[model samples]
Target chain A: MTGTGGRARYLWLGGLVAICLGLLALAAWQLVVLERQMRIAATENMIWVFGQTQIEALNLALALSDEAALQQIQTRFDILVSRLTLLEDGPQRRFLENAGVSETLARWRSGLLALDPAQGADPAALRAHVTALVAALRTKASLVMSHEWQSQATRLDSLRHLHLLALMSVLGAAVAGLGLVAILIDRERRLMSGQLDHLRAEKLASDLERERETSENHRRFADLIAHQFRTPLAVIDSAMHRLTRRSGGPVPPELISEKAAVSREAVARLVKLTDTALMMSRLERDAVLPSLRAHDLNDLVSSVIDDLMATAWDRDPARIRQSVQTEPTVALCDPMLTAEILSNLLRNALLYSPPDCRVDVSVFQSRDCIVCRIEDRGRGMSPEEIECAFDRFYRGSGHETLPGSGLGLTLARDLARIQGGDVTLSQRDGGGLTAALYLPKDDVA
Target chain B: MSLRYHIVQTALMTALVFMAVPAAAEDVLLTLTGAVTDGRVEMTRADFDTMDWHEFSTSTSVTDGRPEFRGVLMRDALAHAGAEGSSVRATALNDYVVDIPVEDFHRFDVLAALYMDDVPLTPRDKGPVWIVYPRDNHGVLADIRYDMRWVWQLVALHVQ
Candidate 1:
């Protein structure tokens, strides 16, 4: 995979880790809150139970006659005893037993039983017994209430302690999570720095290698041109010298015309070779960075079409037709680079078109980008040709009849990439070729 | 074992009879007696103003109708009487009595209401006085500790 793609993958992984940690923190906080609420609910329930028990005991004591009151008190006492057992092992349970309030109640119950109404009871003795019973019931109720209060206090204290501990733990975990995030970010930064350094080193080495290769190719081309020129030049000069040395025979017009034509062809070949070498060198070097500015893509296409007008005029009138589908297609880009790409595509379309065919140039805005297409109605290229169409010095099979260096598309593609765009070639719908330039709109400075 | 011994026994018997005559008369005339010693009592204007004894009222029910007597609370009267006792025995004119512990009185507001509404009471109205509480103030008091603050022909507070 490419370096940028790998970096994006790493960033995605980091994002997932951050999301997971966030969810974990949220879950922990929820649990802590739930536990706190549960503790509060338990304390409130205990308070309610204490209040209910006291009220019930008071009501039972008041409703019955002395004989009956004792039995009711006994029954209530039994219920309270059972409830006390349910209080879990705590200070509340201990308080109930230690108060001896329940024993006092039992004694009062027996005292009430002894004072039978059938016997002429002495008022003093009866009053004393009732008073003792009331006192015993009040003491018992107070003991139960106090025990509940103490239990609630203890539970609240423990809950507060637990809350504090949980809060501290959450804070600690959050801090650790933050620390982990920072470390991960730092590691990622270091990795990116290392990768950048490696890329820079590799690029520098490749640049040096490319420079050496270009120099060698230039030298070899110059030598090949010189060697190609030498044979024709030698023939022309030797023939002229021979003719001059003889000084007796008149030179034949046909023979002189043939020699002149041969020399002309050799010079032309030399010029073509030089121009091809220059184009190759231009394509191999990186294009200059574009000074991006907003410009009308439609106007740029129109201007390129104007430049190609003279060349199109040389072809059959019907074949040289051009059309523009959109106007005022505004975009943010380097106008010069956009013009260059459009000019190259238009040139290719016009060059490869058959006689009496049409070349269409269009500029339009697409979603978040601008598209410029140049279509030609001509014999289309094969898939292989389209694939290699943007490569340096590549010429299609059908382009043998065309007199051109094959570096235009390569140069255009390089310029497009520098401007954050690309060039693509495809077969046209009918029977021709179409070239498209996709330029990204500059939304970020 | 002669005439002087008979005379001493007869004189002791007469002295006992004389002491018993006043006790019987007090029971028949007063209808209620004794102080509510120990603990406290609370009264509100809705019942009777025990603080002012002159104005009293009574509520009539079929089971208990008597004159209502306006007076200070039994506990307060006992306090005023400077009585010292561990309990208060509240008795109706019919001789029905309930012993209220001093501690219970301390913990609860046991009131001796002298009025029902804003009118004077008679015996047929079931009161010369009664004991009452503001039971409607809380749900926990909606039952019998409140009901024990009985109305009608209320009579005596005996300190024990």
Candidate 2:
């Protein structure tokens, strides 16, 4: 319904309907005309009676010539009179009057009535009277016949015209019907082509959008690699420089050891940054495949905490308070991915908070989901930071001083989602940050 | 002697009144000649009067005004003559002839009319007997075929 095709379809359909209605009207009119034509009061009915009168008159004259009996002649005369009476009365009389034969016809009727066969009138006189009257009736019959012919011809002519008009209407309707079909076909083709063009445009737009997003991801990755590698490289270079400067003097063992530890820590930071960057790209490309299953949340959380503490030089049990609010703390997730996500959140809590301040870790059911809540005694993120905290390489301004790859929260959320779970950061109940990892609970337990 | 003559005249008039109209009913107004197993059957006006009568009102094409007709069903007349045929050719007194299918007698309540509005028809009129169809009662009887079957001044029915 878009263009000239739509308008043309309407025009064709409307014209077809109009033609059909016209055909119906013509059919009704034809029925009326045919009914009129089928009438008994036709010119032919009067013409037949007129011709019969002439025949009867001739028979009467013939009977007189043949010397027929009085009773026989009277019967013939009676039949003739009956034919004249048919002309004298009813709708036929009106027609005869119009044909200009009324005066002569009335005279003929009176003359025929004058004859009386039963009385035995003179033969010669009866012959003369019958002959003269027959001649007059002949003239009137001619007049009636001529008028009947003219009327019949006129009727046939009008009927022919009516037939021609009906035929023309039917022909016009057929042409319009064909035209309507052709227009419908053309409209269907145009609509199909239009739909194909629309689909092609949609595909083109989506391809362009995907390409822009991919190029943007590549650009961000390049900046992240440059910035993150440079800081760690500079620290490692500084450590190497300090060792080389002591190389020419009495190199104290403590100084060498301190420099070695500094160089190793920077190398470890670079390694972590490389791993985080690799994880970010893999997750973006949908390449991270996790084997998901039901797991005990308590086991996952405790293992992550144990592994994190084993890697810490000043690890203390008092630094983190653990609580399990449900007996069977089962969550449906990939065990390895869940451990990685929990390790990231707990490590962030310990690293960001003051050393003496204790962190709280709790496992409980929040409705149908199992939540591992990590609360830290550290300043929480602003709403803006929380909004984009899961965007790859998105770190808050003050977080630049902390030892982090800025991909921890993003990878943790991405991995958790892959296992049908999610991680969110919010302001804590007190004066810290809360990181909650939610997973679908295993109903079997 | 004059009182005896008056009594005799009175007796004659009373006898005529007690019987049906036998004055003009003696004439053989209609004759059925063909396909009658019992040979030609001649129907006088009194013969039509004695038969069971059917009545109907109808408008005619030739005549103006609707007229009520009193007559016997043509089927009853055909049955009385022991007539058996598919059709009958009715010959008018003026030699006008038209063939009518016998089925028409049973299909419509067709009448061989002896009277129109209580007046007996004569040859000077369109009947001594005229064939009339119940055109007003049946719409299909208004058709031209049935109209042609409304044979007037009908003198003879030759069943063929």
Candidate 3:
């Protein structure tokens, strides 16, 4: 159910960031604890405490003559003993142990322990002990203070060293985390850039493919134009040359008209070929938008059939049969474009079929459109040819040698489509091709 | 009582017990003292051979290649001297001392080697007795600390 991977990736990144923050927090906490320990160590210097105890003991001995003084002396003695006890056995002994202070403290502790406060309550005895203790304390206190200062300095150095170590470790962790993050970002950037590059490459490839197709189409058009124009031009030139030679000889009037007619026919073919090619080029570019007008479908088809029959050179006119509806069928279309469409379809029907075969033309109104169907009892196109029948340069199978530029069907289709209509070629029933043309009906219809 | 008294008594007893002892037991290679029930124990190559001899092949930093070390286990050697301690301060011929925890002998098959390549070693060759751990067999022991602990020409062990 959880198919979106991008969300998971962001969650992992957030988790990693949280872990890095937690590590930093832990390091800061440790640093705070170490700082607290350093502060406490700095304030609790035992050497100074030991010196104060000695001063208090001396004061107690001076004040031991009265009851209040006696009680004060007892308290002072207890305090001095406690200080000595700290020097002897407390955690601070490690600093004083290496110094010769341990020996002096040990001797004083033993002597002081042997002297009971109640048994040695006499002020004279207490004074003697206090005086000796003071002398011993005086000699050792400064030595102990120097030792303690040295130890504190050493401890401070070690703490600074530890602080530096912690700082370096935290910095190292930060650098490592940042380096990993940088690597991930760089990798993501590269992946994104790679995807962009792939898309760009794909677009460039398609562009190259389209350019290649355009150039190929241009090359085919050039060959077709040259071949189509040269034949007609060559026919006209030969006919004129023949006429000029004959005129220089015996100028026969009947042969002259015939020769002139042949040249005129060739010239007409050249002009028609040029016009068709120019129209095809314009239609290919979608440069001509249709100018529609109301026209009778029956008249349009009948006129087209007459023009083909008049131009029929080898075929008999009786082979084309037309069936037009007696009722007026008006359609909205470009008249000249409709004529070009009908002419191309009729010509193809006449040329593809045998001269003896019948070409049928029918025009009728079908609902909102005017439909014209042309059927020929000729060799029908295969499924493949029928599929590509309207493609620019596709002359049907077995019709390559036929007098055609292969643009007739394409031009007919383009012309029909320009007037909000369409032309389709299909294999007619009983082995022949049929072309159906449809044009939009007039608004009055 | 005194070291001289005990030495004299031992000499008299040795002289009386075996006047024609073998020369193999004559050369003492390792000495043990401190926290030992025997007070002191001197081990000759013959005395080591009398104990269990374990043969193991291992390479050492001081050696060119893997060689078969024939020796008694450190635990057996310590037992021979009646050693009772948590750690042993091993001393080399060059006076280099290092504290080896008794746990090392218990943890690994360490050796007090008397011979290298079936030949008795002298002080110059880093032995009359050498403390060797199977460094090649146990990769964990192949470290500088363990290498330093492998004292060559091991002359004394003070258990404490």
Number of clashing residue pairs in every model?
20, 0, 0
What are the TM-scores, per candidate, against the unseen true structure?
Answer: 0.36, 0.66, 0.47
**Model 3 TM-score on a 0 to 1 scale:** 0.47
A1-445 per-residue lDDT for model 3 (tens digits)? 3456667666666766776676677678668867664544312456655665576557655655443554455545554554554454334455566666765565565465445363455666666777788888888878877877887788788778768767875885696588559858976998999999999999999999999988887888788878887877887788778777764668688777877777766677777788888998898788988899999888988888888766544458788888747877899998889999999998899889888999999888788889999999999898888999988888777777666788888899889988999999899999899999999999975
Question: Rank by TM-score, descending?
Answer: 2, 3, 1
- How big is the RMSD of model 3? 21.3
Q: Which pairs clash inside model 3?
A: none
Predicted complex 1: CAPRI docking category: incorrect
Model 3 score (lDDT): 0.75
State the displacement of the C-alpha of residue A310, model 3, in Å, after optimal TM-score superposition.
7.5
The lDDT values for all models are 0.56, 0.78, 0.75
List where candidate 3 sits over 4 angstroms from the true fold: A1-44, A47-76, A116-120, A131-139, A159-222, A230-268, A279-347, A354-377, A387-392, A409-430, A434-445, B1-160
| DockQ score, prediction 3 | 0.01
lDDT at position A20, candidate 1: 55
- Among all candidates shown, the one with the greatest TM-score: 2
Local lDDT at B111 for model 2: 93
- Cα lDDT tens digits for candidate 1, A224-250: 556655655675677666556756688
